[model samples]
Target: MDTVMQPDVLVIDDLQKHFGGLEIMRGVDLTIKQGERHALVGPNGAGKSTLFNLISGEHRPSGGRIYLRGQRISGLKPEQISRRGLTRSFQITNVFSRMSAFENIRIGVMARHGIRFNLYRRIKPMRAINDEAHALLQQVRLDHRADNLASDLTYSEQRALEIGMTLATGAEVILLDEPTAGMSRDETAYMVELIRQVTEGKTLMMVEHDMSVVFGLCDRISVLVYGRILATGTPEEIRSNQEVQSAYLGEEEEH
Candidate 1:
């Protein structure tokens, strides 16, 4: 009998990042499997955001490499990396405040299809683009709010609209930074379920602080401590790892 293996979707190999005198990422190594939801959990200043920036090309690495599928993306620009099928959302909600929810998502869909804005192009019909954008609005459960200005939606709806925009890019790998931050418990739960549905069949990597959200929504968890990954495993395995408990989870329990 032969065994099948899931291909690695994203690989971080001995990655390093430095800010002048301080070393923020020190030879970090991690892997994300295809079609899996992976979580990065650690205390503040653990370099989780730095790692994401490095991977997403918001910042270049001081050393080492990042691979998407099997291609090197270490030094690529952010837009370049995004064109190659990776996109990310910020910790703060990022949406066009003046644009309606439908229009906000339509911009991303246009980007995905290489439709650049031009004064002459504006007069051309975009029925396909409009339909796709409306479908994405429905996917994120904001179809009712599609006509509303992004600034007018509730905080949770704004976040949902942002996620829809991220998806409109047709990214195979989605990195969400603190997607549930600053939400009430009900909003957090709604976001979690929304994420689960929208990220189906795509790769997701998120930096999250809420333990219940992390444990419930992710298939695998990576414990990053002091700029290094201490453990990576299934939720149950991470729950039982002594070093992980002492290094991060136990501290989380205390707070």
Candidate 2:
């Protein structure tokens, strides 16, 4: 596919973030095309996580602008950004511990379908929403654990549910923060395949520490260093880039 032909769903123009007197993001520019799987990779404290937070409305930029499909969205609140088709999953799994797996996903579908605050109404009676939630669970291969509480699920299963919840939002642009963090080898492989399947035909921006996963899943890769983008290219190009090699992969090679 001619990935560049796709429209830019997210555009960052000279983006900068400052906390107190320290500049966290030093004039970064990025463009994320539609249906592209773009991986943002960097070392610890390189501001990969901070960039995701900034995009998802968790933090306001100190300078520069963020655009979603040509519309400015840098100043919008988190909920407003979500409503505008941007959703994010954190590095840590965030699920309703007390609710059943099915119920948790159902709640997400409800919110996406604009029924979240249906007070005095029984969620069980919402057949449409319930069915959608079940389908999402099945998509994530968690249908068998539908009745189990979120807290009862294994760590990997919980992470799957978290992705499902993010998908339930009907987001056009999904930001996944370390989706395979803390996973075993098998679990990581499974999660990678699951994410690939689920994100087909959607724009995905991910922050991943695993070089293998980044190379395997990303159409393009961006390297961040001390809150700035040092380079962006295809997997092979990034792998061969001297700057990337010296800054990040050199450390990997030493370990």
Candidate 3:
């Protein structure tokens, strides 16, 4: 009998990034598999967010290669990478502050279809786009607040709206940066559940600091230290590994 293996969705091969005299990513290698929820956990100054920027095209890699579904994507513009079905959310809540929640999501849907907004057109309303946006609003549990301005939503609701916008692009691979930062414990719990639900059937990679959220929601965890990965394993394995205890988790427990 033979076992089936999941295909790799994203691969980082000896990835490196340098800022003038400083090296932020030092010969890093990582892989994300299809339909798996993966978490990147590390301490401050460990280059977690920098790695996300490189993958999402905010910063070009100084060396090495990045593959999305086996095609090289390094050096492409953010929109170019996004059009390839990979999109990311920032640590900050990014939304149209003045627009209604419905409008914010509709913008992303329009981008997905390559339709430009023309304020002067005498055209029929796009029922399909509207319907999809409404459905996405429902999916992120923001349908009830669909008509409210984005600025009026609560912090958690605003975060949920951002996730809805991320999904509106029809992305297959999603990168979420610190999705639970600055949330109360209850808010964090709510967010973890919402992330678990919405990311169903999608591949997700996130940089998170909360161990509970990482352990409770992710299928695998990668511990990065000083700009490189130290260990990658299941929650139980990460919890029990002696090296992980000394390098990261043990310090987490002490603080």
Which digits, one per residue and each the tens of the lDDT, describe model 3 over residues 66-185? 999999999999999999999999899989999999999998998788777667754247788899999999999999999999999999999999899999999999999999999999
TM-score of decoy 3? 0.95
All models, RMSD in angstroms:
2.0, 1.0, 2.1
Whose TM-score is higher: candidate 1's or candidate 2's?
2
lDDT (tens digit, per residue) of candidate 2 on 173-234: 99999999999999999999999999998999999999899999999999999988999988
Clashing pairs in 2: none
Query: Could you tell me every candidate's TM-score relative to the true structure?
Result: 0.96, 0.97, 0.95
Clashes of each: 0, 0, 0
Question: Where does candidate 3 stray beyond 4 Å?
Answer: 1-4, 117-124
**Which candidate achieves the best TM-score against the true structure?**
2
lDDT of 1: 0.92
- Clash tally for model 2: 0
Q: For each candidate in the order shown, give its overall lDDT on alpha carbons.
A: 0.92, 0.92, 0.92
- Runs of candidate 1 with Cα error greater than 4 angstroms are 1-4, 117-119
Q: Which ten residues in a row have the lowest lDDT in candidate 1?
A: 1-10
Model 3 clash pairs are none
